[model samples]
Target chain A: MDKYILGKYVPLNTFIHRLDPRMKILSMILLMVAIFMPFPSWTFTFVMSGFNALIIFVLMLISKVRLRDIIIQLRSIWFLLLVLMIINIFLPPNGSIHIIAQSGNFKLYAESFMQTGKVMLRLIEMFGVAMILTATTSPQELTFGFGWFIKPLKKIKFPVEEVSMTVSIALRFIPTLIEETNRIYKAQSSRGVDFKHGNLKMKFKGLIALIIPLFVSAFTMSDDLAFALEARGYNPKAERTSYRVLKWSTKDTIWIILITLFAAGIITISAMHLDLLRHFFPKIW
Target chain B: MQIEFKNLYFNYNNNSEFKVTVLKNINYLINKNNITAIVGKTGSGKSTLTELINYFLKPTSGQVITDGFISENSTKLKFKVVNKLRKKIGYLFQFSENQLFEDTVIKDVSFGVKNFYPKDDGYEQKSKEALRLVGLDESFDSRSPFDLSGGEKKRVAIAGVIAYKPDLLILDEPTAGLDAQGKKEIMDLFKKIHETGVQIILITHDMNVVLEYADEMIVLDNGSIQKYGSPKEILKENVEKYNLETPHIYKTINALKEKGIVLNNVTDIPSLVTELKKHG
Candidate 1:
């Protein structure tokens, strides 16, 4: 459970931490867009992955958050990465030729293997960027940044404040829900629900034992929290003033410039007619 | 089952640099069939102590010796054996009402019984009997646990444990948040449960509950055992020292004794009033 480090902000007095969260959020979106900007070739994918990793390493150094902690946070998603790799492994290349057994059509192309690695690397890069954003930004700042970004939508009568409040509450309750689920699971285990044992059917039964209680308690907690919020004069429509404002610093300006340049570079690369940037599905024989 | 702690130390977030030691060098023997009440202020390791009983928490340094097993770290125990051990000890968590999950009261109570003894034919009857033991009759069995009052929900949660019929029953602040009558009813139910030869360990701040029901008392201060003795002796000697409020009867009795009245030490209100009558 400690491995599941979602949105756990690490307080540090480093350059990355000091950057405005709005800039951080904008940079994260830009980086994500660049990462998902489909690579034209396997070589480009590998090159982009290396570039992403290098950028993440630099961010880690500037943030002063331990690389070990980031790795631990990444461990929770390793299974998903493995599954993606496994799925890619069995798929035949676009123009596959017979490698070992032509009768069974079992063709193994070197390009396909590289393609699998490329996809896995892309996923890792995405997760790495997400982890950085969550680790660097506190929940309040993250939500505030989100609200600020979406502030333009309020012109269309979009109820942006209510939307941001919902998102913030949902984000805040994720860890709380996880904790509550853990408690209910333990309580059920104490009552002889052998969650660690039994076949698949029995395990599902054990899960019900946990889920029912978790829902009941979650509802109760939400009720209490709603009351507390109302008591504190928290109205969604109210013009709320915050204690700490996100100031735009020089570091934010520099980071924003770098991300904008990176985005421009991605678009420029996509427009170029380089052979290395073209998709290549080599035939295997 | 006999429980013993030898030089126990417990720390939270044990692997982190910011780890904090919550309990230190705790050593005590909790004998079977006796009601032992653990009293401490908030954050004084009372809940942590109860967690140790069911092996929910492992000691940071020393051993928790229970029955035929000794555990310092939770990972050392075999998974199946841990479940079996847990089945034999009922734990009523603080604010136990939150543990109720089943749609109906009967299902909630039967949950533990069915889990521990999947093949048992008399689970429904036994669950109903457990509910009855907690003073909820069959008429309320079909009702949703969610619709019940706070005290009723707590009772159903307790019945969920009682249905399992564990040899050792550990309750954490069982009477908390209950009205006066509700508190008394729950305490009387606990006394009745103890009378059935089940060992009871209670973690509470209510000195009155401790004085009236507990045969032995353990006072905790800053995660260390400050005092352990008979309730009468511990309250008389170390109540002020431990920064605990004296029960009303004990306060009056002590006030009279301070004036050289020398009335007999009594735990309950009726007996203390009778002693005062004798003095008159």
Candidate 2:
């Protein structure tokens, strides 16, 4: 369970890794918005989502994160995507524009198939976007970037510093907590607590044994941490120094320019679509 | 029951980049009816070795033939097979008290019994019997396991495993984190349990525990065995070469021998006192 690298930050020296985390965070938000831009034309929406999927793949490669690793990470969510596509393809609640296959009461539509493809592409792009952002940006960087991005919210007493500290601390303890849980799980399993072999009630009852210990340990750990922080004269409201401050470099500016151009292209294409792809590629069609 | 490891090789996260071999080419036959100790430094695959016997971890390439069940990476060790193995072999993890979860001592102790044999109606009886064996009486039964002293909580955890009455018990650092009194009591409890004819496999860093309790010992330096023989043989021969800690008793005996007062190797302080009186 600890070996799952999908959401983990992989430290690598790459072009994307060196980009300002705040810029990366900003681009992530922008790209996510672009992915779900809700264009009036379905063709433009479908095609643009496909294009975004390609962009994610290219970005992953450029960031030095292996395509294979990303695909392996995506495999865990493949079932959900499959279920969605299957329902969209075979059990669409409404009429089909082009019914390609039909049984007595069931029909398969080309339009619904296209719709399923669109859904799959959108989901894949979103997952990819998250993967790229997390894999490139370290947890510390992400926390700092998030805090910086939401700094304006502090004007309304939103406690951005506490939020960032909480994020950083949580990220730090994930590994430690994972190791503890594994130990408890193995210990319980040795005593014949089969977590995999039980009804919901039975499983929950079995889990109570582990949950109590985990809660106790977590409280103990947090208490110690708080004690240590206090002993060291740490304060949330007091301004703290950073070890690695985020700087807006020329690379960050170049990424912003690229993001602007991409956004502009998407806006322009979404504004004017009528049989666009086939119109451009009649021979291929 | 017999455990035979034939060319056993084990690794962690085999499909991931973090994959590293933990145990390599382990071959041994563990005959029944005696306590066998596995002594090794931290990360020397001591716990991992015990984990294999319990089928908590399986070998990458070789067979772990325990009580006639074979585990290897080439074939999937089925759940039913592993469940049967677990029933026959009880494992006491280090700091086992952390596993206590039930509100009452009896409930906590009976957790394993009830978990494995839900159909059995006499789990409370077995749990009570286990608690008695571990030196906890009926007075402590209804109290919350959480509120118990450290030693009492550890016993409750030990009782959880003992309630099932496993034929083979595997203890990983059973004496860890206990006071001297708690340690002796817990060790004595194991001795009493051992007298009942259940074979035991102990993983301990304390050489005194091995010298006093273990009939045979496997001195592990890394993933490989430095010496696999009686504790006496290992202590006499390769122990110093492997840099294993000489037990306090062994150190005292050695110091006496240097003063030209040679005596029989007594494992514990009480035995050494008796041996000294006999010679005097």
Local distance difference test scores for all models: 0.81, 0.83
Which candidate wins on DockQ? 2
RMSD (Cα, Å) of model 2 = 3.1
Model 2 clashing residue pairs (backbone): none
Clash pairs, model 1 backbone: none
Candidate 2 chain B — worst ten consecutive residues by lDDT sum?
B234-243
lDDT of 2 by residue, B160-206 (tens): 99899999999999999887887888888899999998899999988
- Residue range B80-165, candidate 1, lDDT tens digits: 77777888899888767877777799998998899888899899999988999988987899999989999888989999998989
Candidate 1 per-residue lDDT, tens place, A60-106, comes to 67765556765675577678767765665577556544354343555
Candidate 2 residue spans exceeding 4 A from truth: A11-15, A38-47, A64-96, A101-108, A272-279, A282-285, B236-243, B253-280
Model 2 local distance difference test score: 0.83
| TM-score to true structure, per model | 0.89, 0.90
Candidate 2 lDDT over A161-202, as tens digits, reads 899899999999988888888889988888777788768987
